[model samples]
Target: MIWKLSLTGMKTRLRDYMILFSGLAIAAAIFYMFESLATNKEFLEHSNTVSVVGIVFHLGTVLLGIITFVYILYANSFLMTLRQKTYAMLMMLGARTSKIAQMIFIETFVAGIAATVVGMVVGVGLTALVNRLLVNQMGIVVSHYTPFNTAALLVTLIFFIAVFLIASMINASSIVKKSILQLLNEQKTPTRFKRNPFLLFIETIIGLLSLAIGYYFLAEIVKFQIMGLAIALVTIILGSYLIFHSVVIFVISLLKKSNAVVFKKLNNFTLSQLSFRVRDFTQILSMVSILFALALGALTVGLGFRNQIMTFTNTAATYDIVLNNAQKIDQQKIDTLDPTLNVTYDQKYDDTTIYYIKEQFDQHPFEQKDQSVFLSGEVNDKTLKYDAAKMEQDEQAQKALQDLELPEQKEKQIKLISQADFDTLGLDESQLQVINVTDFTTILPQIKTLIEENEKNNPSLGGAEGQNSFSQKYYVYNLYNTFFSGFEFMGFFLGIAFLTMLASCLMFKILSSANSDAIRYEMLRKIGTRQSLLKRAIFKEIGILFLLPGILGSIHVLFGLQMFKNFLSQPYHNIWIPFTIFIVLYALYYFATIWIYTSIVLPKEKRN
Candidate 1:
């Protein structure tokens, strides 16, 4: 009988169940998607620039798991609220408390099972689609990436099922603990607002101070590094919450104090409604604000990393191609490149110094834009110890020598010697060839092949020991591409997931109480309140709810990006792209929330 009644309740409140199921299912899907990426050993190994990629993704998994757990718990609260009246009536009619507990467990578990099945299927498709899109958009070739993995599937199944079971058990226990009278009176009670000026003032002060500290730490992040990041996150989160709790209410109270503004048509009602909603949903607003900042900040920083790649490669070396230990076959490949200018110099290195053949340099006369090589002038004893600090005094020399592609050139000195002196060293001779082509990007594959061959004989030319070695130009470029592309993928993935979950959270919170709010809207309608005015009031109320968090979140992002200044060449480069995407997504959700909230709470016209 209880099972039949629970099923009947579900049928009657299909809209509420739909919202609950969809929210849970979306949460589950995102969890699965994240796990799939995190657990994909092949993908991580292939695409990673650094070794810590696995650890980073694992940490992301834990954070996302915590977030999903909280979301499920919050969404389940609405389920409990929807069933309170039904449970109360059952108990009043002599239904056993144990049977009521069974009903709650059955209902929650059934919904969870259904959402989990659908979520996994959706997760698979989403992962594949997103990975493909990111690969294409970033022009990165990531091999060994598979969206469907048995480990990810198993982990998602186990994690979500456990979460759901725990939630159901908690819900059943809590429902049984409530008295019949309390359950009956819960929805009928209104959330009251009481002003405490002293507390509000204190909260406002604390919030402002916390935000100031967070901004300062972010600005000086290069100095403080990770510790600064931790402090900034805590202070900023606290400030956001306090601002929503006290500063929002204080502003609304001030707006109410103005007689002229209050007397404006429907303005008073709008403010009253807005004030009530703000006071009620302060914590949700704060959470939404933080989520917004994170979503936008991740996307902006990710794209910023992408923009820095080419800029870094260009400035790191002057020539399009720097071929060290150049061979005859290498010259053959270079001749195919149709270079505008080619400079070849014989090089010999010993324990502490490199020798550049002066006769070869004199014949070629390496020049760039009417600037000759800095080592061209005569030196005492025909030798010059390479001093990077002094070399910077001549920009052309700094740029020209950087193209030599010698390992640890900055730390080593260079000597210019005649043929007789060069033979006296008895060191092995290698040729350094610097070539420039009309287009650099079009010849990456050719250049990459040369780099690979060079690295085979000379492993030191790679990114391993000499991280800043110019010989590792190709390696470093690919390293940055893969590293930043991972960040980009993670950013978009989490941004969309968090935005969806947060939207559902706010939506479920508001719509679950629509039945109680409906009575008020109906009473206003019967009192001859125009439908258009009511619509306008709904617009104003929800708009303010959306606007407050959005403004604060954007401000947070504006300051938060300062932390990435050292990591990215231009942290603010092309920042408007992410902001535009964020605004569009946020606006869409804002309108959708207003539409749905209006449909639930407002009284429709009695048309024929």
Candidate 2:
């Protein structure tokens, strides 16, 4: 009988269930997405840059889990509200308390199961879509990536089922705390407007002080490493909550004192509604702002890291191509391509030419790179000179050989050959090709193919297929692009997931209490207030709510990106991309909220 009643309740409140379902499905889909990426061992192992992609993704899992934990609480509270009246009616008719507990448990479990099924389907679709966009828009090639994973699917199911079961148990335990009358009176309660000026002032001061200290610590990031991150997280999160809770209301109260603005038609009502909504909505506002900051900061910093490849490569070397043992066909191919910059070196090595640069070749002095190598953190004005090496079999000489960047060849040692020995021993001739083009990226494929073909025929060149023909810029670009591309993929999806949850939370906070506003709007209509005027009030209220969080969030992003200053050349680069995305989506959600709010308060004919 309880199961039937629970199913009936679900059928009656399908709209509320849809809201609950969508949030759950989106949350589950994102969880599965995170798990799939985090668990892919082959993908992380192949990344060229210095990072533990697994640890990073696992950190992402923890962050998303925290967000989901909060979301489930909100979801459960909404569910309780939806069932309050039903529970009240049941109790008045003498339904057992144990029976009521059973009903709530059944309802929560059923909803979780339904959401999981729909969510897995959505998760698979999102994975494919995200992969396609990364490849098409970001120019990344993902290998051994499977959108559908049995392990991820199983983990997602178990996690959400556990969450739902826990929420149900918590709700079931609370059944004894409320009386029949209290449950029935839940919907009738007027919204509370609580204020404490002294407390508010103190909180505002503390929030400001904490934020200042956080910014100070952030400025000197190298000093504080892990401790700095901890202080910053705690202080900023606390400050944001307090700022929204107390400071925002204090400012709003000041605006209400202005007769010029308050006396305008329906302006007073709008301000009053905003003031009431904000008093209790501070934590929600703060969470939204923090989520926005994180999403935008991730995207901006990710772009900066991705672009670092191009920046490092461009300034690292002069010539676009460096070929060893240039053959007749190689020069023919190099000439046909028409390099704007060319330098040829003709030298005779005393021994094998591949392992060393002849000391006698210094007479014809070839230029070495003026910039630092990719893995090295600094650049020097030092030029490559083989004569500088001690040439002895001592520790210092071996150290000098190991540190030589002139060869730039992976794992190759250089020993200088004497001119007298070069003349004494009859050695083979070798040629080097240093060629530069207007653009290296566009013509890289052709160059790579040409090198591979040459290596296929002449084995003595001893160059790897992809490693041959080094263009300083193109070389670094090829090396680091894959890593940054993966980072960008993670950033893009994490941002989307956060923004989606944040938007849904804001929307639900407004819509769940929409029925309560109907009486207020009807009373206004009876008192000769225009429908247009009432709608303007709704628009003003929701718009201000949406804008407030976003404005605050953008402020956080401005300073938050400072933490990444050391990791990136320009921490704030390409920031507008994420900002534009946030603004557009937030605006649409705002409008949608207004439409729903107005529809509930005012009928179609009245609104028209």
For every model shown, what is its TM-score relative to the native structure?
A: 0.81, 0.84
Query: What are the per-residue Cα lDDT tens digits for candidate 1 across 1-608?
Result: 87888788888877767777886677677777767766666656554454344454565567668777877787787778878889999999999999998998888878887888898889899878866765564345678677887888898889888988999899999999999999999766655655798999999999999999999999898789899989998999899988888887788788889998888767887777666645458878887788778777867876776676666555444566666677643468778888997877777887777777666665655533222221232111222322333443565464457545555554556667787888787887887777777776678888767666765655666533454344345655665555666666666656776676677767776676778777777877888887887788778877887888789999998988878766665778778998999889888888988878787787454210
Worst 10 residues of 2 by lDDT: 401-410
The number of the candidate with the highest TM-score is 2
Pairs of residues at least 3 apart in sequence or in different chains that clash in candidate 2: none
Clashing pairs in 1: none
Q: lDDT per model, in order?
A: 0.73, 0.69
Deviating ranges (above 4 Å) for candidate 2: 38-59, 132-146, 174-176, 184-198, 218-222, 315-319, 336-340, 352-425, 454-475
| Candidate with maximal lDDT | 1
Candidate 1 residue 512 Cα shift, in angstroms, is: 2.4
